[model samples]
Target: MDYATYIAGLPRVLAGAGVIFRDAEDRILLVEPNYRRDGKWILPGGTVESDEGETPRQAARREAAEEIGLDVALGPLLAVDWVPGTGRPPLVSYLYDGGVLDEAQLAAIRLQEAELTAWRLVAQDEAGSYLAADMQRRIRAALGALAAGRGAAELEDGYGPADLRAR
Candidate 1:
């Protein structure tokens, strides 16, 4: 087969990285994208630039810094959600713990005007009101794993408990 044919036949998947940042009040930080017509509030993150050979964790950290101007150390992987896409290849999303930011860090937040318009810390219960249903599920599962002292979770379409038993 020609190189072009081989490349065309290769399976492709898109990857994105996001950080789950919480305040001392345990509220999740969410951002509103200025470009989205739907006006969905989303976690501070963006697509991993594959050409840069960026790992998911690195992408998460970079995105957090670029989006919120907070340069805090990222914690463990909270969750990995595999989402089915529409008119595109599936996506694997990585969520990292941004480690609870202090008041100083919160006060320093500066949204990227080109991509984000505003950001706010929302209570866990009210997160659903701002985020899409799938995002709400992913956040809730990550929070549960955090509270239970469990390691990272693998999810299918943001659905939980990841059925990791041997197939």
Candidate 2:
């Protein structure tokens, strides 16, 4: 096929990037989105604007600023999850470390009311109750990756790099 035809025939996939911000106590930051009625909380992030020539890292920074009103320099990438379709195209998500937030920074938060209803810092163990299964996995993997002092962890459907019952 010709270049244009080949490009047009390529499978479509969605991409997102997020920043994992933590409190001084090391609690993970989670946001309640106004869009989801299911009540699942998520990290600060959104769809990558590829059409606007935005990269994953740039998207993460932009989303963080938009959602939580903080402009921060991100740390190393923590995790990447590949999620299959539930009712739409597949998705690939990138997670980066936003580092710790000080008291002043925490107090300065201004939620993007159009998208977020509230935000909280939840303990690592408490993340499960607020997040989706896939999200829990991604967060665990990201934290594990950070703790292990390694590079990013790869996940499939937010499950595992596990060919087995894995971490």
Candidate 3:
């Protein structure tokens, strides 16, 4: 096959990035996306513009800024998940640590009216009630990685097994 044909024949998947922010009280910040009718919440992030040469970190920063008016130095990555879509292609999701948001940072939040309707800090345990099952698992993996002080947790379908979480 020609080089172009070979490249086109390769497997493809979508890429996205998100930031996991925390409150001083250790509550995780979740955002309500307007696109979902089920009232499910998610972390602040969007698709990675890889075609435009955007890295996951840059995508996280950009999404944070666009979704919540946030502009702070992000901490290390907490999780990297391979999420299989229901009908669409699979997604390679990067979850970065946004660290703890101080009062000043919290006060500066300006939700993107078109995309988000609200944002709130929810306790880790309470997060499952507001987030989708996969998201809840992703959050758990992310937090576990953060607490472990290890590098990013690797997940498959949002479940990061014990062995894969610390790498």
Candidate 4:
């Protein structure tokens, strides 16, 4: 289980899980950071922690509630990103699709000032410029698979933006 590698890298490694919730109208939910650096814009998520009897999914829900104040219904896995040798820290990011909860359900959020500042629902088309290259690709894959009546697409195998280019 690569326990040795996992342990040796703990201080410099992290695992994060997050979801991109979508509504029936097909709009995608996104959060904008109050600040930006290194030309990077990221989604709302944080390090996945291991608590007694808690799974990664549970951690993800907790992160969502902590960051956005909503209890999300988690759906299928969308992507698994590996960030090794990126110079900051090695990370494995799990991206999921927490099915949409009504807007009326959103209340004032308690955000981690260190992670986010604002969030909004964006049309699938605008995701490119706003998100980092990889995140944009993941959003495109999720939207494409959703539009085709299939379940979530895996990002592990890799795909190109042209696979999701606007029609």
Per TM-score, the best of the predicted structures is: 2
lDDT of 3 by residue, 54-103 (tens): 99999999999999999778899999999988889999999999999999
RMSD of each: 2.9, 1.5, 2.6, 4.9
lDDT by residue for model 2 (1-167), tens: 79999999999999999999998799999999999978999999999999999999999999999999999999999999888897899999999999999999999999999999999999999899999988998999999999999999998877765633754
lDDT of every predicted structure (CA atoms): 0.88, 0.93, 0.92, 0.67
Candidate 3, RMSD to the unseen true structure: 2.6
Model 2: pairs clashing at backbone N, Cα or C within 3 Å: none
Using lDDT as the yardstick, the better of models 2 and 3 is 2
Q: In what order do the candidates fall by lDDT, top score first?
A: 2, 3, 1, 4
TM-score of each: 0.91, 0.95, 0.94, 0.72
Candidate 2's error at 73, in angstroms?
0.5
Tens digits of per-residue lDDT, candidate 4, 90-158, equal 776777777765657544545666768767677778767778777777667765665577765655323
- Relative to the true structure, candidate 3 reaches a TM of 0.94
Separately for all candidates shown, the number of backbone clashes (residues 3 or more apart, or on different chains) is: 0, 0, 0, 0
Backbone clashes (count) for model 1? 0
lDDT of 1 by residue, 29-97 (tens): 999998878767999988998879998988888898999898777888989999999999999998988
Lowest-lDDT window of 10 residues in candidate 2? 158-167
Worst 10 residues of 1 by lDDT: 158-167
Q: Which pairs clash inside model 1?
A: none
Model 1 scores a TM of 0.91
